[model samples]
Target: MIDPIVMIVTMLIVGQIAVSVPILFAKANKSALNLPLAIFLVAIGALALNPIIASMAPNWYALYTALAFPALFMLCPSLWFYVEGLTADTKWQLQKKQAWHFILVAPALIISVMILMLPKETHTAIFIDDTEVSGWFVSLILVSMLIMMLLWLSQCVYTLIKIVRRLSHYRKRLKDLFSNNENKELKWINWLLFIAVCTWIISLITVFSSSLLDQFLFNGTTEALFSLILIWSLIHFGMQQQPALVTDEISPKVKNELIETLDNNKNEQSKASKTALPTKKYQRSALSKEQSKRIADKINTVMQSEHLYLDASLSLHKLAQHLDISPNYISQTLNQTLTTNFFDFVNQWRIEAAKPKILANEATILDIALDVGFNARSSFYKAFKQVTGQTPSDFRKAHQT
Candidate 1:
């Protein structure tokens, strides 16, 4: 009979899997993180079902077990892919170069095939008595399992290191590109990576410390719990986040082109600034005071007249396009001329737009927050306090009476 705990876990896994797969593929689920996450849930669900299958069908258990090992190796790579999807500026897709990451699985696959090749009587005999297994075969299996665990541990460590480096670089670049880094920071992806690292650590420990049967059951139960937590958090945090329109670190060719353009602009600016005073108050950048004022004026005029901040999906690339300027140039102008960033610069206008509505008592605070492009009332409240030194409610209260 299947273990009672295993059976209960299996039911939970099945129900969640059934609900999750459809939602993952639904039309509303557009994030690149969705596919890898769906695959992760399916892999965990298959693992969860293993105990039930073994109890119900003894003859096919070896095959089931063999097929499942590859998915175990896939978890970290899926997570890495999800992070890449969030961080990469260009479209994220699995490429041929990344195939090398899976080379660590070849030994496990070969060993699994070897297990599958065993005669039915041999499989049954090995299941019943340890002494029936050949020493060489047992050694091969042990060595392969050891190698697989090492690969898992190494992959987890490598991924965590990459995530740290990538997030650091990403955030630094966001500071350059966006005034408000709150939405573009991709903090949820970091949480996912940290949780995955913990799960791998647990698996690594269970592998060495437990007997074969104990390892299977203990690892399965523990990993199932982890999987449930991961899936729940992944969906909850992930589904709400829209991928950034542009991330840091685009192609070298494009970066070089942007550098060339900026350099050209600077040469022209120097000639123009030759007669102008060197110490205008807002003229901190190498760009001429004239050009900085021109761009800043254009930015404000467009923002005031077009109300682009109301779009909620507005981004640096989109704003640059609206002004017919390069994104780098827009960022530089904002940083140097206004001493602000894109996120703050835009949301400042949003907060400005929201104030009149709040003072007029024309609508609910939540409705006004949503109308002014904030996705959440809490986010609006935070930005409002940051800008006005008062919450929306407090500001409204003081102004109304």
Candidate 2:
């Protein structure tokens, strides 16, 4: 009888392959994300399939095992690249500098090849029967496997840390750039990383434990289930993810100039902190304090008169175009002078606009929320409570009584 664990692992491999093929071949889905994502899915599938093949068909397992280490090494880096592709401010392309990420794969591949070159009887004795084999070649293979496992674990730790930091910076940049960050937040990625860390911890514990504990904790069923969940979540959320920085509306030259100015200002600020200068944010900005005040006033006047905040799709770039200023400068003005981010600055106006309507009590709260620039009622409720210290319904009750 086929083991249930074997069935589960088989299903995971099949499911990943099913998802990966369409993504790899679909022309419409071509982007920086697709290639790494496809590779990641396939690599995971390969890794999951390795043990099943070893038990069911030992003869073919030699070649299959040769490829398995490289697959294992590819997993974390591929996931990291996918995150990089998702949150990149510009179109992400694989660069030569990123080649180092795959360096471990070479040594892993070489060791796998050495193992493959060993005699078939040796493979059966060492892998299938789990017999102790003492020779220079066998010792080399065992030592290499141990080193690879350690390196892979370290790589997982390092890459996960990098991914978390990247997500933090990406979210911060989103606040500076977009007013409505509803779908673009990529919060699921955080959950995915958490699950991955948990799975890694379990596997680490299994590795250090006795054989009986290892059998219980590191069984095929548990690993396959975790892989299934991770792959499904990754595919579902990743397919819908759009580039965080939408560059289609803004020209490349203008975007580059704005980015350069922001970088220069940051560098100046960092240098100033070393010398114990007035540690004000944006202290090196070309916009003077008077100009910042003027810009802030301009923003308020425009919001009040034009009701630009009423546009649910309002963004720093769009606001900059309306004000005839750089987006970075507008962001700088909001942060330094107004002491708020673009998101909060705009949403506060939306909440204020929503108040009189709420007090009038003539329309449904959802209706008022939609009419006043919030895309969804939940966001409206959140912002309203945040800004006014009362829910819309509570505010109405308080005022009406």
Candidate 3:
């Protein structure tokens, strides 16, 4: 019979499996679903690979280990694909063949891991190894898994950093800045995807560090960590509120051409939308475009006098007051013409101005970041990433020599 601690651990493993398995099948390619699925697979696999759990429930353990390995490799690619779909403002879809790619590797990797158990495959047995394995075979498994994990991890990390860089400027409308919500609320789901990816990373760390888990168990820290991780996983798994679904055969070619002409084009070559003014100088019933431009020009003059952008904390209200225009007018002017909010408009200017100074090397990242109106390092990193599509370090390096 399994000891009490072993039984408790086994139940914990089962609970993780129970929560994650269904999510794995349900949330495929969806950012909200993708990371949760990865988390679930890692949690289940980590438990199965845990020495104590393996000793207590060998069959279940082996089955889970086999399943989780390739999933580990697949998670990052799937995440990148999901981000691509998000970038495109569409629901991700994988054809049948693409869905089964992980399964192709499953049988072989699993079979190899369980090669010694061929004779005892049918027997319900548990084996515990107290001594740490330092042999060639164990090392091979560890090294291979590490390499795969690192590769997958790197791909996701790079993509997320890129995503963060691309989305850092907008403070008020961060959701829409990083994602599109024209068809469905994909933006909201992308936030949950970030959480799920972090949870998946936690699960991976827990699973691959059996000795550390044993140490924690000995020091009575396992329960606390497990509880936190379990709760985190549960929260991440719950991210599948509703998928951005569309059933119609959307006109791909026409939409693609339009997107290429408008969305991707640096040049403004498409007709303005029905609601948008054909010319920037359209007459308004209450305040004409000429009047608005006068107001904007006066505000620009005041901004130059006060150097408001240097404040970094300057807001719509303050700018509007100084310009003798309502905040609504300022917001509308920036949004309609610049295709961005007032906050983003100002921040973009600051970040752009800072880039040259960053290249000049008169100040460090922190000083330049703060000088550009960003209060914190994180905000600085995010703002720079958004404006430049690269980190400050990257941007600096590119222009330094």
Q: For this target, which candidate reaches the highest lDDT against the unseen true structure?
A: 2
What residue runs in model 2 are displaced by over 4 Å at the alpha carbon? 25-30, 205-219, 257-284, 361-364, 389-400
- Candidate 1 on 40-74: residue-level lDDT in tens? 66676666667777788787777886787777777
RMSD of every candidate to native, in Å, equals: 7.6, 3.4, 13.4
Per-residue lDDT over 116-151 for candidate 3, one digit per residue giving the tens place of the 0 to 100 score: 432233222222333344556555555665565566
- Give the distance in Å from residue 31's predicted Cα in candidate 1 to where it truly belongs: 11
**lDDT of candidate 2 over 184-302, digit per residue (tens):** 88999988987777777776666556365545556655656776777778878877788877575678866875565335334223333434543455555577778878999999999
| Greater-lDDT candidate between 1 and 2 | 2
Badly placed stretches (over 4 Å) of model 1 are: 11-42, 114-136, 161-225, 232-243, 246-289, 301-311, 352-364, 388-401
Q: What is the TM-score of each candidate against the true structure?
A: 0.67, 0.88, 0.42
Q: Which candidate should be chosen as best, given TM-score against the real structure?
A: 2
lDDT of 2 at 247: 73
**Native-referenced Cα lDDT, model 3:** 0.51
Model 2's alpha-carbon lDDT is: 0.79
lDDT rank order: 2, 1, 3
